[model samples]
Target: MSETETCDLFVIGGGINGAGIARDAAGRGLKVVLCEKGDLAEGTSSRSGKLVHGGLRYLEYYEFRLVREALIEREVLLKSAPHIIWPMRFVLPHSPSDRPAWLVRLGLFLYDHLGGRRKLPGTRTLNLLRDPEGTPILDQYTRGFEYSDCWVDDARLVALNAVGAAEKGATVLTRSPAVSARRENGLWTITTRNSITGETRSFRAKCIANCAGPWVSDIINRVAGSNSSRNVRLVKGSHIIVPKFWAGSNAYLVQNTDKRVIFINPYEGDKALIGTTDIPWEGRAEDVAAEEKEIDYLLAAVNRYFKEKLRRSDVITSFSGVRPLFDDGKGNPSAVTRDYVFDLDETGGAPLLNVFGGKITTFRELAERGMQRLAHVFPNMGGNWTEHATLPGGEIPNADYESFANTLRDAYPWASRKLVHHYGRLYGARTKDVIGAAKSLADLGRHFGGNLYEAEVRYLVAREWALEANDILYRRTKHYLHLTDAEREAFADWFAGERLAA
Candidate 1:
């Protein structure tokens, strides 16, 4: 709280990697400061495919190490954040032209045995012609495989890590950007400017971490005035949201003729989330969106398999994100490795850790190993402990979400079943904090269509660093998917007026 403050670690970028490192470092008894350019997870973190999965297709590229590490992380992350993450079965309808049945079985076998899987169910053969999951599919696809993967509330996962870091004594600053940093006299002098107030602040950090995702290289060259031999490939991926068509809880995985796979997963209770095309992108990461051609391609892929034909009009909303993949010199964008690399510059006595490429599943191990790279500097820092820790609101008995849901119903018996579900799934053990002492529908305040209530919005603003209306409607919660356009406009107007009066 001065012109210049000093800390053990200073982290730039408030995405999952940055927040995760901050939490891990702080919990290890190290002083930490984390700053973000925008709201937490406002970047690619919130706009991801939202699956905590091991890249099943990576087997073709011989990335067994990455797949194994990711597979192991699935159960660890699920236990750590049970409320926001849970297992979902994916039904991959077999396509003979794309891959042989024996090859598929071999991949599935490796997926089952390669990792330390304890909780998630293994892959099973499905009869597409006889099973209800296949009722919507064409008769040609008679045999399929159903496998397990975890779904995550990607945006909330970032927020929870930030909150956990703050609780562990880290200075968490939202709407703050690290404009510049320089190493001098074995310390980093970093300047951060608050975007909201236009106020500049400076700090002295023992070490600095660059987790800027798509902006990783810019941070190295422009902010730190340093260079890394490693580079990040900005491949863009896009997803679209449509009304839920099928009856089961299982998600569908379709193999396109292009040999790329697309996921159609259940989203926000009543909708289906479909996605993803890997196209080489030259545009700015922030400007990426679902192009018209990508949308048609996705629709066509789904239309080829399911009885429920989707049109362009059926797509309610779509988003895109640029993956900061480490350049492996592969010609194909999809063939690029999802593995991560770290560069430590300790030449000036002050260390600068540059995180190159990483996925959500591997962030924990990445942080642990990253800290190990700097062990020579801080010999007294604690050992790795995040493998057994619970994230905020993830303290359920044995990470049992269903048992916890039942308990939530017992506690909030007066609340509607749907309302209880919204709170339970989002807040978990912390549901009481959102519900407070409300005992009836009147205490929930105004209803803004669907389950978007004034109480939940207020909770997010007061506790979760929610500033803009879109922060509450889109990122922190998926209320936009269920609300009409008129309702969303009204909510935005109301939010604007409230902020002005404040």
Candidate 2:
């Protein structure tokens, strides 16, 4: 048995909510430990639709509070992490067969005004026949509307939160699962075993935060031996990556005949990300995959609106995530609320806060509110600090990304514009830390592929808890989509030989 450790709070998930909670708690002067069963954001957090929007479709369900909160959070996050989260224009072409044009206009009006509309521009009507944004659309559709939303690098958001938590004195353990947690003498006796090293550790925590996402109930019932009347509805949404079909940077939101809107967003410079089919998933969350029908359905939706048609072969890759939604007694999975619910089971004074069904957009607010819920448990904790604080590497002056990019270009004139942009976007003010004293590209060491270099890999392993190649390629950065099969294989071989695990 390992020596028993103690912490003020034990967080049992590495997704957005869990990381957000850990970061908030740690910053509030609480000794925290965040243990994840897998790599950070390897689950649903990384596999989202990659937008930080107010959920325009959610308006139909009358989730005004959820949309308003998310919309407000949109600007908040954009201000904090300007490098990764920025404004995006979404073009929605109106069709007579689906939603009424008047209804769409009404919703857009509400969306613009609901959140106190700041920073981002308001919606504008476009004549598809005359506007350049409409060039990709079919000639029959003459009118469309463009609205504002923000695109996010979802996985990096999780990593930055975990980084912030660790920096604030939280112990973050990746690939370590809390196998057991029991209430003994008004304290949580928890045990976590590292999956890689096969090492076990014990802890006596004052409280436990169950932010296990899709496995929220499993942690409550199996790990903590606690029960919750609140339940999570496992709704699986899938997305596909295809070559960019349109000519612009703007994304398209097409209304499908089934009443679900599918997003075809620009991705990876040269590719387009199309997705998201809302289907009820009964199987295990880990086993969720993008079904062929879901892919076909997305293609049909995009093809209906665009002149260029997509086929099965055009799909470069696809991914799916099982959303752990708070079951609101809604028969339709799409109709389920994206709002988060907190269940604090304070039996024996050992509080266990269980978070359920939150979207990526509202994670910071969710964390703040979650901490407020635990105010009784942590009376000495600090006040809300993340509202204005920036995440790790998001320390741009006035959140001006263009000015920062210009500075980087001036500093590293030897580096390509593409490489500088990569570092600027991913590392932001920490770009110098990654590049180090390198005066030229050669100082960056062996180039794996794309903008990926040995220096970046080493930096990720050292700072971001990247123990696996996929953790670097897939999550911390999206070099996987840019690198070729040969480059990836070569990089994996190099990573294994180096034994970079700390």
Candidate 3:
């Protein structure tokens, strides 16, 4: 039999929460091992609405604590990773038939003040008839409200967390699933199998953290053979990508007839990311896809407010994700609480921490609090530190992305404006590592379409754990949106061939 490796912590799942916990625990001097069934953020983490905001709508549910924590976290996350996270303005067009003006104003006021509003600007009223923001709006909606929120590259956020954890001496294994776990001799014995290599590995961990998101219940019952009173409610949220009809960088939030608000955000420089229906999901999380009805429902909501009407054909692509909400016995999916709950099951001498229902906005806080729950286990571990620490590649001086980008442009005078912007936005201070000794565009090697080059691909594979072409084309970078079908196929072929050759 193979030797059983040992660690202080064993983390299941590579979603945002797991990655965050691994990074937090590892930074605090705990030996950590994180195993993911698929690529990092392949689940719900990458498929979020991509906002780090105080859930403006959650205030209706009276979730003040969650909203407040998330609001405060927005600035913290922005400072930590300015490259993938930044401020975004949301335009909410007023509809008399939906929410009353006074109620909307009150919500905005609370949203502005609730979390100790600092760097972001306060809300402003807009005349849809006169302002350029109203150009795409219908004549009926004459008033609008604008507020602040932060946008994040959800996939990149997870990747950075994994990177941060690895840098802190945590073992991060992708494409490896924890198949079974059992308590043995006052410790948890976990067995994981690598899907690609068909190699099984065993570990003896002092404790286990189940951050499987939608698969939390499965991990608890099936994998760990543990029981918890807490349950996860799977709610499906879907988003559609289409050509940008509106002309501004600001996003639009319109109220639907059902009293739900849909966000039409600017995406990929030229596309609009419109989302999200809150429907109770009963299917397997992996099989979840944007249904035709959901797509039509989204188009109808946007068309009701915008002057331009979107059709079925206008939808370029769509995605769906299941939000594993902590079941609060709410009848309405929309009314269900977004707050997270932790279940610490110490059945025997071993401990199993099962995390349930957390949003991307409060992931760091969740990790910090999760670690606190295990403080007694690691009494000598370091105190809170990530609050001010920057993630990998986020070490831009003063957290000023624009200033850093300007410096990057100066350093790479031979690079194109678009290429420089790409590297600056994605790699930040690590742009030099990707560019290396390349003096000009020719040094970047074969152009695979858009801003993707051989050098960038090599860097992602060598540093970011990018094994598949989709990892680079879709998640690591949005090159899929920019590349032609033929170009994408050609790139995939090249990637597969190169991998085989290696």
Best by lDDT: 2
Please rank every candidate by TM-score, starting with the best.
Answer: 2, 3, 1
lDDT of 3 at 400: 97
Against the correct fold, how does model 1 do in TM-score? 0.98
Candidate 3 lDDT score at position 244? 96
The digit string of per-residue lDDT tens for model 1 on 1-502 reads: 2479889999998998999999999988899999999989988899888999998999999999999999999989999999999999999999888888999999988998888788989999999999988998989999999999999999999999988888899998889889999989999999999898888888999999889999999999999998998989999889999999999899999999998999999998888999888988888887888899999999999998888799999998889889999998999999999999998888589899999889888888888888888788778999889999999899899999999999999998888899899998898888998988889877988889988888898999888889899989888898888789999999999998888888
Model 3: what TM-score?
0.99
Residue-wise lDDT of candidate 2 within 1-502, one digit each (tens)?
6999999999999999999999999999999999999999999999999999999999999999999999999999999999989899999999989999999999999999999988999999999999999999999999999999999999999999999999999999999999999999999999999999899999999999999999999999999999999999999999999999889899999999999999999998999999899999999999999999998998899999999989999999999999999999999999999999999999999999999999999999999999999999999999999989999889999999999899999999999999999999898999999999999888999999899999999999999999888999999999999899999999999998887442
| Candidate 2 Cα errors over 4 Å, as ranges | 500-502
What is the per-residue lDDT of model 3 for residues 1-502, given as tens digits with 9 covering 90 to 100?
2589999999999999999999999999999999999999998998888888889999999999999999999989999999999999999999999999999999999999989988899999999999988889999999999999999999999999999999999999999999999999889999999998889999999999999999999999999999999999999999999999988899999999999999999998899999899999998999999999999999999999988999999999999999999999999999998988999998888999999999999999999999999998788899999999999999998999999999998999988889999998888888999999999889999999889999999999988888889989888888999999999999999999998888
Best-first order by lDDT: 2, 3, 1
> lDDT, candidate 2, residue 307?
95
lDDT of each: 0.90, 0.95, 0.93
Better of 2 and 3 by lDDT: 2
User: Candidate 2: lDDT over CA atoms?
Assistant: 0.95
